[model samples]
Structures are given as C-alpha cells and as structure tokens.
Target: MYQHEPPTEESPKEYKIKHARIYILLLIGQVLFPNKSGNTIHSKWTQFVVDLEDCGKLSWGFTVLANLYREMCKSVDIKVTEMSGCVLLLQAWAFTRMPIISLVAPLQAPYPYARRWCIKKLDYQNNPRHHLQGYRFRIDHMLQDQFIWRPYLGLAPQRHEDSLIWSSTTYIICFHIVEMHQADRVKLQFGHLQGIPEEPQCLVEHHKMTTIKARQKAYTTLYSDEQNCWLHRELFMLDGD
Candidate 1:
C-alpha cells in the first residue's frame, strides 16, 4: 500500500507556450495533409487530441506511478526473500511494463504517445548544434516539470517534508538506478559558465486568447516560422527595440 501526504491548496496556474505551437502545428498538419505519405509511419494527431482530452485519467495514472516508484524504492530495506521479489517487480515495472511511458506519459497534459520535443530556445553561442551542454537539456526538462505539466495537473504544492525528504529519496534512488543501467554517464564542464549572471526573460507573454474560439483563431493565424523564432530566442538576452 502506498501513502501520500494530504493534498493541500491548489497548485499554481501555469502556461505552456510551446505546447500551443504543437497543438497549432498538428491542427495545420491535419488540414494540409490528412493522408499518409510514402513513409510507413502514420501521424497520431487525432489520438494526441484524444489523449489530451483524457486529463483525469492521465492524472490518476501519474499518481499511481508515483506511488509505485515510491514503494519500489522503499523495498530496499525488506528481507532478502522479499528483496528478491522487489527486484523482479521493479524490473517488470521499470522495463517490461513500459517504464518510460508509465512514468512520463502521465506528466503530459493530454497527449499520451506524442514524441517528446525540447521546445527551449537553443543556445548556439556557448554550446553549438554539434556539441550541446547536457545541463541545458536537464534544466529544460526540470522546467518542463516545474512549469508546464505539474501546474496543469493542479497538484497541491509540496510540503517541506515532501520536498526535503520523501520526494528526494524516492526519485533519486529509482531514477539513479535507471540511469546507471540505461544512460551514458557524461561528465559536464561548467567551468566559466558558473560566473555568468542569470538573466530572466518573459517568453510566455504572448497575446492572451482567453476563450477557446479566440485561441483557435489565434492558432490559425500563427505562422510556423514565427513560432520557431519565438521559441528559439536566447533566454539570457533581451530582445532589442
């Protein structure tokens, strides 16, 4: 059995600008090219829309997966025989039973199977296209968790205990194991970058379309190149007048 702290006040209201682009892109893609091309892979735009609509189910699934992960990590202290059982169960959960999807899919707002894309503005000056900084990717991922989906789920804010203890213990242990087996350990070099001061940019301040109809109108008018440029802007640099 898994236990979690009681849900407190509602989470923060957050917006995902990049996802709006994806929604608009899929909308355009469907209108322009409804039929499949020469490639064997078929587009999942319809299913993606359907998945987005299943927000409740997605949220529940996320809760279950979080508990399961917590329980698996807790099993480290059990007897040897029970530990063997835990190992098998962890393997099934982490591998055979579609671990990535089970863990990450619930975090998504509405889409289940959509290919994950990093929508952050890439830094070309410090880290070029060929050699990308791993930390940048990790930061982008962390922001996605903090800003994008977590808020959408309306999860309560984490308590001090949850933040300082349970959350850290469960995730670090479970994910560290996963990375140890599956990931290529890359030592990052952040020598001089540490001294550089942080610059905050307001990228999500786009024209607010409150209503669904208004949003749909805005999406129809939004050009792909414009969206790309807006998404890829340097976070640390302010746009010139």
Candidate 2:
C-alpha cells in the first residue's frame, strides 16, 4: 500500500520495517479510521506507528468510534460534500438493531457481531434511491416493538463480559479528536431503564481545537486536555449510582 515503487530485489531490513509500518498505516487510513481523503494517509498517525509494538496497546476501538461520531456530526453541514470515518460500523449497527430493514439475516456469530452480515457481492447499487427511501420509510415508521433494543441478549456470555464498558459515558479521545460517548442517553441499547438525559456537555471549544490551524498551534495542549478528560471520564457520567 506504500506509494513508492516496489524494489526489484529483496529489500534491506530497515526498508522492510519501514514498508511494514506504511502498510499498517494504510490499513488504518483505508479501513479503521478512514477520512474523506480516501487512500491518502495522514501524517498525524505516524507517531502512533513509531513504536510498532506499542500500537496494540492503544484503544483503537474507542478511536474509531470517536472519529465516526465526529464525522457523522460534521456531515450535518450543508457545505460538507463527503462523510468519512468507519461508516461500516454505522451500517453494521443498523443491520443489527433495525432488522426489518436489514437485507440479510444475521448469523449466529460470537463476538465481532458485524461479521454476521459478511455477504459478499450484494448489489446495493441497483435502484439505490429506492432502497434508501425504503429504509427511511421503515425507520420513520418503526414501532418500539419492531426495534431490537437489546439485540445481543442471546449472544454468548463471554461477549457480554468482554463488552462491559460498552455503556461507559465518557469522552472518547484520539489525539485531536474527542467525542462524547453519551451512553446514558441510549440506555435502552443496554437494557437499562431510560430517563430524560441532561443536556450534552459543551464541547464547542474542543471541536474548534481540532481544526488544522488550531491543531498546528496547540496540538500538544489539545491532546493533553483530551487525555485529562479521559482520565476523569467517570465524573462525566450522568448517573451517580
């Protein structure tokens, strides 16, 4: 996935290592945390790959979720031409929770529930708008009983154990990107009683800090403050008990 031409012969050890890092970054950009730029990997991710071994220790799932939330929010702007981030997550979420609109039946899989809809070569391009309107109509008229509020209930016990923190109300931080995980607002997803959630935390300044110019000027400060927010994230939860 590196931009450079392939070497004619076996590469040097250093060259091989560098190529591997580039490949990993490509996977991150194209799959995990894709942006609107398509295949163009951002330089900001270089620091994470510098110590390749430590990359596994990072909270990559949270980063993906944070970026996806940020991109979805940004898509509200009428001027925005393209949406980005791991949109596949959104699709998988919809398929799992809104089964009436799901094209394929979910498989009885263990964890990584997204794999259930791994049907290849499904033609969604045939009358795309018709499908879109159908989905919209279903969602718009969906009754509470038709929605699978707790779709994972029948999954293996181990899956539930592994996802204990899925309902955490906290700030998901990934460098300049920080988005609130307002789990309290969506308690039904976790089989909890729903209550009127308070107004969301004001993150306007933090959002502004993510701008290119602002990131250049205060990248360290922004990341530090985000990290601090994450560290004390329990305090941000709506429920005290």
Please report the candidate that would top lDDT against the real structure: 2
TM-score of model number 2 = 0.78
- Winning model by TM-score: 2
lDDT for each residue of candidate 1 in 1-241, tens digit (9 for 90 to 100): 1133333345322224335435544443332222233222224333434434453233222223433443444465555222211222343332222222222322333322222222233223432233346434644554322322211124335422222121111111111111011001110111112233334222232222233434455443544444343234233122111
- Taking the tens digit of each residue's C-alpha lDDT, what string does model 2 give over 40-150? 877778888888889878878889998898888889899998899999889888877876776553345445667656656443442233566877787898898978888
CA error at residue 148 for candidate 1, angstroms: 22
Least accurate 10 contiguous residues by lDDT in model 1:
179-188
What TM-score goes with each of the models? 0.18, 0.78
lDDT of each: 0.29, 0.74
Which clashing pairs does model 1 show? 51-110, 52-110
Model 2: lDDT equals 0.74
Residue 201 displacement (Å), model 2: 3.2
Clashes of each: 2, 0
Q: 237, model 2: CA deviation in Å?
A: 6.0
Which residue pairs come into collision in candidate 2? none
